[model samples]
Target: MELSVVVVNYNVRYFLEQCLVSVFAAIKGIEGEVWVVDNASTDGSVEMVKLKFPQVKLISNQTNLGFSKANNQAIKLAKGRYTLLLNPDTVVQEDTFRECINFMDTHPDAGGLTVKMIDGKGRYLPESKRGFPSPWASFCKIFGLTSLFPKSKLFAHYYLGHLDKNATHEIEIMPGAFMFLRSEVLKQVGLLDEQFFMYGEDIDLSYRILQHGYKNYYYPKCQIIHYKGESTKKGSLNYVIVFYKAMILFAQKHFSKQKQNHFVTMIKLAVAIRATASIIKRLIIKVWLPVTDFALMFLGAYLLIPWWEQFRHGVTNIYPRDILYALIGFYLLTWIMSLWLYGAYDKPQNLKSGAKGILYGTIAILVVYSILPQNFRFSRAIILILSAWSSLSITLNRILASTFIEGLLKWNARKKSVCFIGTASELKGSEELLIQAGFHRNNITHLLPEEVLDEHQRAKKEIIADAIKYKNISEIIFGTEGIPMTSIIHAMMYLSEFDIDFKIALHGGDSIVGSSSVEAQGELYTLEVIPLAKPVARRQKRIFDILSSALIIVLFPILWIFLVKPLMVFKSALQVFKGEKTWIGYNHPNISKQNSVLKPSVYLYSKWGKGLTSTVGLDFYYAQHFSITLEVSELIRNIFKTQD
Candidate 1:
């Protein structure tokens, strides 16, 4: 046997399928066998492998065995001269295997090799070539000296930034996304250390290869698209802890005690710094709009209060000092909280939502005024005028921020001018899928191939370049029907400098997969609908839960008369208030809770004597089309069945 490709897969079902499609295409004529060790993926990955790629050797683990242990399981069974550890989120070119094999055959002392890798966006990944993480390298990396001084050998040794990316060179370490090794070298260095579970094992193995008198090469002749962090989210706090802990473990195993201590301290410091930065970033993203809105609203109300006092009563000091400030604060808080409940602060800013929320809040303020003592009843004119001012101001702010200011800032703007490159049939199929995935038809531009082309491939490349340059295309989709993986790969490589997002539409597949940037996780544009998972839907749902639960508890005296078990109703409301349960959730046995975004609930909509098959069907419908009104109606209908 010449090559054995082992891919460790997690819950990236669609990415895994596309990767396997490319893998089989790459290994078409080679004497190679493929192995996929699935780590308890619940996303139908094992089933996909079994059904789609039957020739692949499969190892279905009952639980997550982590990366190293899973790869070791496959390596022990691999029967070939070269064992290639491939990530399931990567797509290889058709000639990638042949080129790597030829290079490996020529280099007698090369124990390990890795090809150049790009992210889903077609941007070159600097992790393709890296120096060993020594104490100085770690210091440089943790403090971001590597990024600032990328080509400086002293400051940027972490990624070996001074090296030419297009040329092959011997490197100290290889990325775990694509590590090719001679089986003989594996026998000498042993398998990946199980101690370093996921992040640092590749470095540990690379260091061991060097210790065993073999060279590690970074061969740039072959390139693959590594959709980074498909198996796990890299920006998450858990990822930070696990990755740095692995680094500390490597230091402990390899360095002296003093050096290990220094490295451990630096790792801890890096973790602390990252954790702080992550928290600050999250707070800024989640709270900035609300905070800014509140500040502006408060300022507006402050100005309105003084002017209203003078204009309405012909006196500035007529109202009580304490009551005036307190009531204004209360009013502003109520209005902003109502806006949040109505999803006004949601992304793609909804002006109608803001207007609606403020209208409800004004009605609420009028109701409170009617019930309050006569002494505390301020001017109704003031309240009415403030309501109009608040609504207009909020709408104008959101309009300017989302439409004009955010455009100038280029903050999370939607991509435009989408183009698809492929055969006629594949282009049509991809267009259908793109529309089904919710992309606007008007935004997509179908730039047809030049009909008078002599050399079709070269023409296609020129078409892509012209589309990017002239049309200012923000996104490009490559269809795999008539285009070879090599053509797609070369097009991406040659046009890597353009500011465009690249996605691959598998031939006859239902999804298109890509990442917008290096830091982003692999994103798939699919027809799957989970309304409750959207940010606006989730926030509104939680607000409904809180308000409904509070209302239930407050009106318990009257509500108890309609309930079979009144205390159970009270307890369920309390549970919902504490976020222990939702008001309505899926109850079908066949419908997995993991597949839905809702929590366990006190009430179920699909429990109306439906059979086994229809129970799941109803649950699916409920999950996809859930609303606060649906929950309210269901709760009212099932008022006497609270014990269930």
Candidate 2:
């Protein structure tokens, strides 16, 4: 056999499926067999492999056998002249396998090879061609000298800076994502050292290949897309700990005790320095908005309100600085925490998320305020004004920043560019929905009617691939209505060459389901991340309803004479305040005959608390959107319309 492809999979079933699709297409002319060794994935990957690609061999492990050990399991049984260790989260181009095989066939000296690779975002991974991570190289990498001086051979040598990324060259390390090996060399140098679990085994194998008198080449004639493993988070303490321990293990196994001690010291110092920087950067990013808002609130409050004053020497006792500090800290923490609970920073950094974050944050702060002691309390009115102003400021800041980055800096304001491919009927109204859903205005879309994309006479994959190539579309969304799943998957396989994204638009409203590039759990779709999906209910939904209702009950009683008509109109709303009914919904208890029609906004949804008034069936729009501002607007309109 020419090749034996070994893919070690752990839970990334969708990615694995796509990778296999690409791999099958890649190894067309070669005599090859694919082996999938699953590490006990509960994501139906085993079934998918068994059902979809029946020809391929599969090894099922009950527990997670780490990458090195899993690959060795297949290596022991591999029959091909060459064994290819491949990551499940990768897509090989059609030429990738052929070129690598041809290169190895020509170069008798080359025992191991890795081709050029890019991430899902199309960024060339420097890890694709790296130095041996010698003490100096590792130092440069950990301290970010590699990025700081990318062109300088000394500082940037960790990524082999002197060599061009597009050129084939001798390299010391090969990423486990795509390690092509000669079977004879593997037998000589031995299988990957299983002692070093996941991260360092590749390094150990690469180093041992050289010790056994073989050269490893970074062949750039072909390229593949690797979604890049993300087991450890960057700049996290756990990342530093896990990764450094791996480094120490490598040093102890290979280097002298004195060198190992030095390596350990270097690793510790680097981890400490980098982790501290990571923490500070995170804190600055997280607290900047709340801190600024706090400052503005303090300024606004001091300017607007004044307590009793003493005329002696024209001076009054100032509010204690310690108390003011305490108040500011309390408010800042509450507001920031509330925004976090509201998912303000989820992604696509838009008006709606910010508006909703502040709205939910305000409600949270109110809850906190009610629970605080009299001595801790300050201006509630100022807080209300602060919430409104903060929302406006935060939104304005995001708009300006996004505009500057997109317009001036020529960066996409939002990273994911979507292509809405739909049937003619589905296309008519979806563009506006997608645009409003935070996709760039210039996003490409294709309308191939059912007749055009019929199974018997389906549009060629070349046509779809060309469109994707031209638009540089990052995400492909199929209208789930008329399009068959087989066609969708077929089209996906055809255009799988690009390091891009895929999603499916649900039929009814604006909801779209898609795969997550960040996670190994495949084919999981969440409205929280995808702005195109329906608005998610706030975590503070019940609290806001209950609190808003209580305030209305208290204030309405005092102003009942003036608000007689409103009170009569708000009788149902009053019931909401009393907890007898909800602040928004579809069902009415008493008024079964007169079903008043309420116009739809994004926020109207049946699952939400019943409001004072809404159009008939309008509450079901929670399936589309739900926002505090949208709710308030409808409530005002409903009240005034009753008088009319």
What ranges in model 2 sit over 4 Å off? 40-51, 229-235, 290-295, 306-338, 345-349, 360-384, 396-443, 447-644
Clash pairs, model 1 backbone: none
Q: What would the per-residue lDDT of candidate 2 be over residues 390-485, giving only the tens digit for each residue? A: 677766655654543322112343555667777666655556555544456656567564533755544467766776778777777677566644
Superpose all Cα atoms of candidate 1 onto the true structure and report the RMSD in Å to 1 decimal: 5.2
TM-scores for every predicted model: 0.81, 0.63
Displacement of residue 306 (Cα, Å) in model 1 is: 2.1
Model 1: per-residue lDDT, tens digit, 43-124?
Answer: 6678777777899999999999899999999999999899999999899988999998899999999999999998877788
Question: Which window of ten consecutive residues has the lowest lDDT sum in model 2?
Answer: 591-600
**lDDT of prediction 1:** 0.81
Provide the clashing-pair count of each candidate structure.
0, 13
For residue 225, model 1's alpha carbon misses the true position, in angstroms, by 1.3
